[model samples]
Target: MSAVPLATPTVPRKRRSEAELKAIVDDFNATLAADPEHEPTADEVAAWAAFHFDGTLAVACSMADAVLPHVVSRFAPGVDVLFLETGYHFSDTIVTRDIVAEDLPITLVNVMPELTVAEQDEKFGPRLYERDPALCCQMRKVEPLARTLPLYEAWVTGVRRDEGPTRADTPLVTWDAKNGLVKINPLAAWSFDELLAYAGEHRVEVNSLLSDGYPSIGCEPCTRRVEPGEDPRAGRWAGFAKTECGLHT
Candidate 1:
């Protein structure tokens, strides 16, 4: 057979201005206000967003076990769910990822850091997470996310007011200055108990590790089990003088 042409990758175009973004939010809010119980269908939301934004929407799957069903059940299939695969996750975390991906009706897009573990170690030296967390995070999390952010109009997150200080004021909708795209926090006001209740009510699959003192899970080397009365995310990047992996920060 003759050689077939490979398809060219499509780079996302520039995003709308702040004024345009504000208008879109205003319109969305109006729609929600007019019919609180009659929320726009996920397909409808995705379609509406496509007209305005030009970047890939992402969600940290850390606690998504509680919300993935609602997002999948409501949104269109093939709606991208970008998972940052930072190459340092625990085995259980990977297993959980497999379980979630197997069941969800989303187009799971696994985003990875540009370098491999060995390569990263070679370049930056081993255990760089202990030495320079912010730089390490920039290499592993921020840069990878920035690479893909321009592919969708908005990104969704599972952040909640209960997560703690940094995320306490996370708006239901806001502009992410760093990524320059609309960020949607559908579960902003949801309490941890509320999330648990929803998961129980829906029989959603959760990370097995969650029951084992790991309220927040991330790369294996950085994460640990939290103590009682500690923040749920305390286990993540523990003792590294860091909290968020730059998704929210």
Candidate 2:
């Protein structure tokens, strides 16, 4: 079992007002607008955010891999790493989450939706993901994350541009107006190979399913193993028109 944080570590710096936060995003973007190609390295970006947001920064991780958390934690030790506990993950994923929480300098936040799997089934009927994946995702993933994101002034995501067309334009930093926070994607420029290399170099705990061909891991029932030459994200929400779970969209 994951050794979850009893309580989130206190951020010495108070969260800035939304207006102030938005200005910071604007300033950062404007500074980098002149040379997108000359953007700072991932570690440099993480350091900038760590200094600016401090305790108000949250990292969203799916436990598919711990590379993002490992990278971010170097700059902000004991940062809160939010994991949506939808109660539908594979055993391997749960194990990986457990190991990561114990091994890394991070606080594990097991964010849960209002409804448990049983409650969701009792309320909305079983296998709702088959009937309506969007609603299932909204309840199990999106809504829960939306409710939790407001506590922070900024967030870090593991999104990479090489994942697929849907994420081809992922930016390193942007004002996530939808979540009302400054969104940071430090791994935006990394490829799958680069991610694996980092994990190997740092000895980060990775979900076993990743090597089992499930590159883009999501809920167990909704995810599949990708065939060769297929896009990494093709395994997620297979047979459906959904490319995203509505968190980034």
Candidate 3:
């Protein structure tokens, strides 16, 4: 999240009652999880979410790769893809995001934090990520996302099961208690190889850092290149026990 220009404010959309949304999630969970042996493909899940949520859906992309947005936009063209502009991203990440917005059949929503990088530095002192990554992420990533997510009834994420232990049991569909909306992880079953394969097959624009050893790209300051045989997300928040940025948990 480098210092950038102001983001276009997203107009909050009318959301359905929480009860109705929760019931929908319950129904989807039951229907999709009915079969023990068979699981739905990412495309199948995306299609289901597309039809069910329709215009009231959003896809959250870290710009690690454009595969998630590419997969979902096939079913729901012009869907809003929310990119958290924390003003601390790697240059490659930003480049990938811009390319995805131009190439994909979706609307790009630049979700910015309430304060700019300078303002945050002034108030919280410089290099807060080094002092307390959790609080930094809360103000930069989680809060901004939480603020923008309500404009949609449901939100789709690219969280894969193999990312690490924290997301090992991620479900395909569930009620997002934290965000108060339907949460869909279409690629929950996908492996790193599967992800790259899809990106290559579809000719999607991927962040250059992926091939350069930064398996899990995050804010420049908190991220580093991971060694071979390390956890895919080992590069993120390197020195702390912080596994998540307070988004999924």
- In TM-score terms, which candidate is top? 2
What candidate 3 gets wrong by more than 4 Å, as runs, is 1-14
The TM-score of candidate 2 is 0.95
Better of 2 and 3 by TM-score: 2
Model 3: how far is 185 from its true place, Å? 0.3
Among all windows of 10 consecutive residues in model 1, the one with the lowest summed lDDT is 1-10
Model 2 segments beyond 4 Å from truth?
1-9
How well is each residue in 1-249 modelled by candidate 2, as lDDT tens digits?
Answer: 244523243484566788999899888899899787798889988998999888888999999999989999999998999999988999899888989888998889898889989999999999999999999999999998998888888999999999999899999899999989999999999999999999999899889998999989999999999999999999989899987999888
Highest lDDT scorer: 2
* Tens digit of per-residue lDDT, candidate 3, span 124-224: 99999999999999999999988877667899999999999999999999989888889999999999999999999999998999999988888999999
- Arranged by lDDT, best first: 2, 3, 1
Superior by TM-score: candidate 1 or candidate 2: 2
Q: lDDT of candidate 1 vs native?
A: 0.67
lDDT (tens digit, per residue) of candidate 1 on 1-249? 111112111234565576777677887788778988865543355455544443334444553363643454354444466667778777776676666667666555677788877899999899888888787778887898788776665777777778888888876667777887788776777787777777788778777777788777777777889899999888877766678878788
**What clash count goes with each model?**
7, 0, 4
